[model samples]
Target: MGADREGGARHRPVRAVAYATCGVVLLAGCASMPDTGDLRDVESTPRQDTQVRVFAMPPREDAGPGEIVQGFLEALTSDDPNYDTARKYLSAEAARKWDPERSTTVLANGPGTAEDNQTGGREDSGNLTYTLVGSRVATVDAQQAYSPAEGPYSRKVHLSRDPKSRQWRIDALPAGVVMGKSDFQRNYMSVNKYYFASNSPAVATGQSATVADPVFVRKRVDPMTQMVRSLLDGPTNWLGPVVRSSFPTGSALQKGVSSLTPDDQNKLIVPLNDRASRAGSGKCAEMATQLLFTMQNLTPAVDSVELQGPSGKRLCELNDDQAVKRPEYLYFLDGKHQMVRIAGATSTSAVPVPGALGTGDRELRSVAVSRDEHTAAGVSIDGKSLYVTELASGASLGDPVVQSHGATTDDRLTTPSWDSHGDLWVADRDRANPRLLLLEQGAGRPVEVQTPELSGRMRIKDVRVAADGVRIALVVEKDHKQSLLVGRIERDEKAGEQPVVTVRGQRSTTPGWEEVTAMSWAGDSRLVVVGREQGGVLQMRYVQVDGSAPDGLAPAALPGVKTIAASEDDRVPLVAYSDDGIVRLPSGGQWQTVVKEGSAPVYPG
Candidate 1:
């Protein structure tokens, strides 16, 4: 099958907020993206030109309404241009009104139940509705916005036979389309739009932490436009509650401009609607930061972001570095659980953490340093208690701020994690009543996290909250099967000083893989997972927050691995405990041992 120049299907973005162009236009817009699809690695399997391939044959001769419904649903998955074949399965009137691009309901691969409702109850007894039910994986909205869903879902198609032709064609149905997971990968592309943490205090300091909102866009369409519009539309429902956007409400792109083009200097030029005309310079700068961080992820990533106001006047321009997330102060505990640090990912030596915690006499089992490096939380070797110590000079250490009643020493708490909001999280893995607790300011009577998704048979093995306060990674085991899952942290909107956050929806980040013994956040939206295939040896790999692994060779195997730690920034190295003892992975090099005596090493977010 040949590849069609005309790309197929409804793809991504947030609802496009069109701006009223005040007679200002950029001629360099939408000038065709480089058509380099052929340059991609060729596939081994024979492919088909979806543009001409008939997905569903026009209902079999004199086909019944049930067949019409089935055929119509099948055609939607076919990448036919404008869904021309799908319309054939619809009545003339329905054909004119039916739109499969309104949205897409992606389902887990399986046979969807198609039931014919022919009870002969209505005035038009022959007129019927066919129901298609399945486990919905996600819903891509009319704007190409994707939102994951849980539980069950059903789709209804109304059909009536063409009396004159003695044939059936769908008459009524929802506007959106439905397809299995395989088709989704073929036509959809995933992109991340960066947004500053909604509740972070770093915003005031011009060093706000950013979070990644992953979204899917059509492969051949104006993805830069789709991504920009989606970023402006805000995060997905699951993530919206936990993040904030710099684009003020009502701000949008210039009307008729669907393409975001880069200037000769590779700086992206974003034309904004009048909604941002009144924004102060500072606000405009923040808005630019959001766009710079987001647009930099696109292919031929932009080096800078230039914002044009309603009047076409330059509001602001910012380089990618200027919009970078602040550098986190990293610290790890040495063999003695004493705070220490490595000069760089390739550095073979370690330095002591700042002040007393580095020189303290406390014997600890595990330690976690705050983002600011001002405090540290350590669990006792017995694992029954948690302690917090000031990292300042001669600062005193606090008594056990948290205690557990684990029946055995092995059923104790794991390492603690510090979020951008100064909150510490840890999991108490008591086999009987496992608990995930959030301790404010490094310690205290923990607030049992109310994430119902993590409840039930599974026991929590490890929990690490990302530097961005909105996400958490957990490794759990149930009936001997261990898996890695990530959850979005939600908090009360008005929970000002005393914030209360819970792990709302926890889903697998390393799906299908079992024996996920160790995992850590490698970046805002990436995780370094140490997983073992069923009955296979342990292998270390990287996975996205969306559960997809990075395409390429897995990192060199680090057998006999006990645990791992990674800096929140992807630029930082990934450190792990392996047969070679403490080892680190350079940017593009093999893993090299950094410390022979190190155990459970970590980079503080």
Candidate 2:
């Protein structure tokens, strides 16, 4: 909606008060407060030029109706050049009608006999109140009761008089037709179309044409302009009034609209309903999806192994003794943690390293796993091209998709997640703060997701998908304070309301843990977090489905856990690190070191 404009419609302010009350659910981004519109007074007349009424008074205490009427006629048809001669003989009512200009013209043409009075025929049959303005003069109100086109029009005129001098004068009025307030309102409101063609020829009988007002033209063309315009136009039309009344008037929608006509009421409610429907439709539903994961290494891996979480089994391992050394490789695993496939396994220049090397960086710099555990995506540490491969066919989906941010770029990609559509959502933490980028199929530009609350002030440590593809998770760092935020991406098309997009923080159960590093979906609802304690102990924590803290949910004995993933059944989680190796922990807290390689493994969710 647009704002209210001046001169078009007048708006009156109504009394209202409001205070913000944040809810348990994310509500910080609520926009659009109520605005009130009051009725304005109307003052416009119909005729530009018209005659005035003249009343005449008599000398007697009680004058006959005919005598009073005759005096009024003589005053209206006065023939004195200066009007002084005529005014001297007028009774209080007659003097009021004697105009000097009219008298000059009448005298120039010479005064007529009594038969000339019969031409217009002045009548005074009813009792009309004559106010005494002076000792000898009194004046009665007059209505110009006749018109050339539409005869017998109603008009009210004020009369002035001098009682002592017995002088009277008729009031001057503008000439031509004029419309009243009711007429104007009826003409505007009764039409379906806001405006009709002013000068152009009309369209065909059944055709409709949009008027070409400059303001209207700008609104339809400029996306943001329309919103700003609505803001300005609200006071004049429905925008401001509806918003003020429906939202903050301390009145409910029904109650606030009760005073408006049925048509006006519908004008307000219909658009509001449409806005809510669009917001709801844009929200994601409950569903699972698979994402691809790939990482770059200073030294590439010579072997890849997959472990099945169910029954604590090893599924498959791929080993290449003399294969080409690849710079980075993205890996995908099945529900059983078996190696699905690795994409971007090509030659690189880095020297080989088998054991843990602080310099090697071999654990997949960028990775994204599909919800269904089928498709995977990976990018190198540098913001280079993205590699996506389907696990089922062991085939590359297409050529790598290049994504670069800065002028001088790194040959690496960033961590990519999946929105509901299984499209890739990645963040480049290489900048001042992590920036979000959405890559969709058949689209020329990636959707840039940057919020003022997150972009410059908060740094993104990790981006992950919830079990439900629609929910997004981010480990954001701001002011040295680390927090986990969960939110559904929502957009608000209406300018009057707040942008529906928002991110709310979750409760942290791990005490003294300043920041969270990674997250893996434990189920369709639950999520597991890897956090560093203030004492520098790497601990595993579980966050509930909702954004509540996972107090008392971390295991007491697990150590050096660099990464963690959930089992297919969600009954146990797999953890890996440089010291404790790969340990498996059941939901009941039983633990076992399943591997000693220290390869950072993600869950097969």
Q: Model 2: per-residue lDDT, tens digit, 191-257?
A: 0011121112223332121110111111111212222222212221211111111111121112222
Any runs in candidate 2 off by more than 4 Å, and if so which? 1-364, 381-383, 392-394, 402-414, 441-445, 479-481, 491-512, 533-536, 545-553, 567-569, 577-580, 587-590
Off by over 4 Å in 1: 1-92, 99-102, 106-175, 180-182, 203-208, 323-339, 354-357, 390-398, 430-435, 443-448, 456-458, 477-481, 493-497, 532-538, 548-553
**Candidate 1 weakest lDDT stretch, 10 residues:** 1-10
List, residue by residue over 1-605, the lDDT tens digit for candidate 1. 00000111111111221122233211111112112111111111122232222233445576655445555655555435467767887788988987766788877653254445354424246576656666677777765555556567666767776668867577887787776666565556566677777754563355676788776665534557878888888887667777888788888898978577678887998999888656888888878877766665545346777888876899888875432343354355577767676665556677776665577787677788777766888787788888777767777766777777888876888888888767888888887778888877766567777777765888888888987777888888888889888888876635445556678777776655779988887655667888777777778887777665443355677778878887655556667888787887776788887878766687765
Lowest-sum lDDT 10-residue window in model 2? 286-295
Candidates in order, TM-scores: namely 0.75, 0.36
Instruction: Tell me how far the alpha carbon of residue 464 in candidate 2 is from the true structure, in angstroms, after superposition.
Output: 1.1
